[model samples]
Target: MKKLVNCFIGLTIGLFSWTGALSQISIEEFAINFSQPVDIANAGDGSNRLFIVEKVGRIQVLDEDGQKGEQPFLDISSKVDSDASEEGLLGLVFHPEYQQNGYFFVYYTATVNSIRDAVIERYSVSADSSLAEHSSGVEVMRINQPQSNHNGGDMAFGPEGNLYIGVGDGGSGNDPGERSQNLTLPLGKMLRINVDNLPYSIPANNPYAQMGGDTVREIWAVGLRNPWRFSFDDNYDLWIGDVGQSAREEINFISASENVGGLNYGWDCREGDIACPGCGNNQCDEQTFTDPVHWYGPGPGLSVTGGYVMRGEFYNVFEGHYIFAEFARDQIRTLQLSPGRSVAITATIPANNISSFGEDEKGRVYAANLSGIIYRVVEAGILPVELIAVHIKKENKKVFLDWETGFEFNASHFEVERSLGQESFKQVGIVPSKGDAGEITNYQFIDQVYRPGDYSYRLKSMDLDGSYTYSMNLTIKIENNEDMLVLPNPALDKIRVGLPVMQEAGHLQIVGLDGAILHRIAVSPGDEDAIEIDVKEFRRGLVLVQFIGEGNISFTKKLMLY
Candidate 1:
């Protein structure tokens, strides 16, 4: 028995029983225009406001109270070299305890000593919150780049109260200094430091801190190409999206639980588990090397865009999927990876020339296009619960269904369908819709029935603008069976499934909850190794593991890799 609220306007809406969603919402227009919007962040301070960073070194503010203010929060273009597309203000991050500290960090290309280099600067907002004082910008950490191109840009704070920075391999072409794997250089790696210490100090427990060599103690993971973006989930696991050179693009997952530091992924040595012919030595020891859990080649429109592991409170269906985008590929791709398997692509949200993906305080993902359009991803056709309670009654014969259209996009009408059995469904009532809400309108329907039976209902909303979407199914079930044994629920690092212990060799496909295949492995039963797959190369979140044995027995299990 679920409770309903009298929340907003009295709206009658369809019901969501257990499964079946109502609609899929997409970006209708760009949120804010920018010459090049690299990233966006929300205050998370109960303020539905967002901060946008421009490539040319300016920060713009957009408030959710329906207010849009234009004035660079901080303009460093005069101090930065905005000539090159990649040279300007590259990254920005708000402090985890920003409400009190008011401290924020920025990564930019500064012309120091007549040589351009990447620098991270710390700034504090004024007591009035109107502007950040110019003198408050303090030098935190700086890394000198050998070449111009691979100036690793993004910087973020992990859940463990450490600042993580992205560093690309020293520019020019193919691993010139072989710097990605070299612990000495900060290029081409993810570095973490504790900001609680003065300025910033390397965390003592960092993976490479005890290497005893001249390596940077702050180096958390190395052997990466140009890692433009990296983020951590609530569980403190790290997710990295490294832009590939030519052949492939890869995403990585590092579990905080493992505490396995110094994770040296093969960069110039290998791209996504396949040996680079030019790098020589086709076969190398697999023990010391970590392979990418998810990777893809340069398809028609393909370039690795970083995404977020759906950890927001938006909806359950998309709860744990990793959402990413492709620049040249122009698609929002989600990756779900399980232990002992590669990362698999789950969902593909189409867009034109999308460059970056962003997440707000609510955990909703945003896609910004190179064309200067920004679209927030939302549930296409959804209504509030309070709206679902009205006109819904268990009459003697049939249930009366009525719902007021709340937020709609190109909505045509509501076609109510019912099912006694989960399979067979028939049209019961038709409710007409009046397109987009120039203004809200109410609608109703009734199914006159004589016998008492279980039923399920769904809304088929069509867009007069030529689009169609369905709502989550509403079940009035009489009885149901015990849930299937979906083993390895929320698997961490690794997973195993028992299905009569087949002795056949077949292929295995790992998928996400959304039915997107995450990993496909060729396996031979009776092999002792149990197939060693690294999730470090894929995005972190909930994933599905599917195994097809030689006997054609298929098994599916849900897994979560931190």
Candidate 2:
């Protein structure tokens, strides 16, 4: 079995306390059992689904909950060339208007008549919305491959909706054909094309789009050995993970805002910052090409697996970090770029065989390995409470709050916080925790003096080392002896109900418009003021949330699920 590590905030603080302790990030398994997964992408649709590209010519779907679908969304194994380990289905991207056009594209290696070639094709989703129609595929472009090892099968859509394809120099030990620097060949260059047209059209802004002679109009940038993976950040800046020939693995970057192109990235001339040994100084002119933004010696890793910049809210600490990994090292690392364009490794994750890095619709990052598992990246030391739920309720003249935790590691206490209206929460009360325990622990607090109005409450879980994380905010309305608040009206996956402090017990029911009761939850005096209910499994539409408290105090609200 593969070794799995689950580090809950406070439990592994010491393990990540490095030079920049606060900058480190951690990982937890998200999904497993994939066959040679090479890439991951989202449809850009509101469905919040993830598409995993397996190198064996299939695309698997993972729902928002990280559960793999029973059937693949797309499969084209018959046309894929899997004879070479590096050849097969390699890249996938959904059109910017995928939600409307249902168009998606994939890059793969195809074998025909004992020769292998790289192909890019577009496909549309099936009428069922869950599966892709293989028959809907239309060939977009195809390039003859001289050798299979360095096919450079990765494609991504730029901010302008143009497709950028990475092609390796005709594969061999070195650029024997000098194809990278040759403006006439598409090999070893980033190609840009407008795929909205039949057979694709060259982007007008491409470096050689209008150049006459033997110049290939699709060339964008040149001199890349094997750019295995690359991505565009929110700013449309391109980042490339170019596999090294002998000494260094490099990450090349280009800002889209520059608008300048036709630049050469030293490959045959230079492996990284140094000259390629035995290649001579024929084209090894440092001033002639752009050097990589970052590069590493061939010890800790071999090939570079470029990842996305952290734009997700789940890991706030890594907000602007550029995450990347190595194939041989099996390590996930982050880079922080200084204002001067210098880069530094801020964190490292001890993983194995990380083949690719992916993001969900919400921007949460995930890593996939050759071992058939994917892990979600999270901030290492935070959320010490591990709270299962936190709620609040209001009675005749008093308000009560309750919370439960599945486990606590070095937890010292809980600070009951309150805020009037939308103001910041203030410390109102403190409840000592059960110290450090692995079993379930429940706690509660009460406020006897409070005016009738709107109030919000949250729990501040504190650790012995002064670290803390806050729970989800729970709000309540104190009106004429009644209190209830159904939150996150437009819910994506789950909904929460805030109950009033009660003298006895009550029952809460969620009913659909068709007069069908979907759930019935019991509420008691010491129960949490707020209760979370998973509504993702429910149909998307309007639903009634009803709560009947002691003394027949009832309240209802309409919820919209999407």
Candidate 3:
């Protein structure tokens, strides 16, 4: 009956796009008919066929283009004892080297004599691309559970060729058994193991193995309550969204290269830096267990939904952003991370009972709803904002104006305008759009040959119906001055700087490619002979060098640091 009600709700909200209030994000519902789809995975083989995991122990196929396939790829519902509610099929993973191995693994509650145990079983598809129930599964590993609730379920292959698994705090709120904090137990922790060798092999570099302690050798990072889902970015950064008890929901990020062995995420010790009554101050070590970079409490949702980092080139704002969801309230939020260990919310998408987020071969993300609908997050582009960029070059005075349809709307053309000072303006040109780009779109117009001195440009992206909106004016100045230069474009260790002679001190700032300011210093050619900027701590990316010298002169240069 509950499933029937959920199906009805999904059918009711099936026809429209879910747009949240904060940012210009649009969602399209696809693969609507399913029985409690919990997670989805792409084959990455250009087949466009997506494997959707049903929590009730089944794998359905969605066509590469996101159309619902007529049949399921695999179903082990009879083998699973889901009487315990959380016991059915929880996670599924395809071997990264699957083309050669033809291997797959599933995490589920296998029932034997009415006793349900958390098990990871490996299965291979038949030559016909179907699974058989003739007991063709090999039990890779199994952990006996006293209770059923917190079966931290989700698995993914990391860049280092390791399979990572998430385990819960062994059920019942507040971690009654304290299993998450106990390194000896696998519960309430994330485990990483190498499956290249038959069943599974423990990696030599696994933090616990080298540390020589009571920690579980397969444990990657510990102290997680119940991480429903976690995935690695293209660069292998691990983003884990762990479910909170009562007060918080968190998103944890760890750099792949930085080996933080036995990193405790303060589950019972702390939830997002707030102490729980059960965890005392004296018990909490001053070692500063890494708290979540950002977290929120249940305001609109019951549980926190984990998502993936968008590395696809199709969208700009979504790139490098971690898109997450709230299960109870159906809100999709984006966390923008900075090099300096800071994060900000760029946008939040609207959703309902969003159980999991999946990625396809093209790197676009998909959100699975318990309401029986699956939605893919595509770059609908920002609503057409009237804006222009002015570039001044010798013999080529150019003005670039960009506009597009805003969220949930369609835009058509853009009218460009030019201003001499800040007041008097004249019509420049009219750029026509390719019609309504249902999603956010980026359009540009260039105007050549303009008068000297400072110039400003504005634009209005109009709708096909004659309604329009204005854009922020862009300003540019035509000038030539080689005031500063950063040697060794791909800089390392120490970077040399050459500054033009100035009367007073100048301010120097190093901004990352993401517009994050990393280093700032005041330097004056008259005061200091030269400045050597340190590039050791910098990661591989494009950087901006800003120099503000005497006479308030500002110079910007892009530096590539490896």
Best by TM-score: 2
- Span of ten consecutive residues with least summed lDDT in model 2: 1-10
Q: How many clashes in candidate 3?
A: 14
Better of 1 and 3 by lDDT: 3
Candidate 1 Cα deviation (angstroms), residue 41: 1.7
Better of 1 and 2 by lDDT: 2
lDDT of 2 by residue, 66-147 (tens): 8999999999998898778788898998888889888999999998997778999999999987899989999998888888
Question: Relative to the unseen true structure, what is the C-alpha lDDT of residue 465 in candidate 1, on a scale of 0 to 100?
Answer: 52
TM-score of each: 0.63, 0.66, 0.63
Misplaced by over 4 Å in model 3 are 1-23, 130-135, 210-215, 278-283, 286-288, 298-301, 382-562
Candidate 3 lDDT over residue span 35-146, tens digit each: 8888888765556667888888888888865676566778788887677756678888888877677678889877687565789988776676544233568888887765
Every model's Cα RMSD, please?
25.0, 18.3, 26.5
Ranking by lDDT: 2, 3, 1
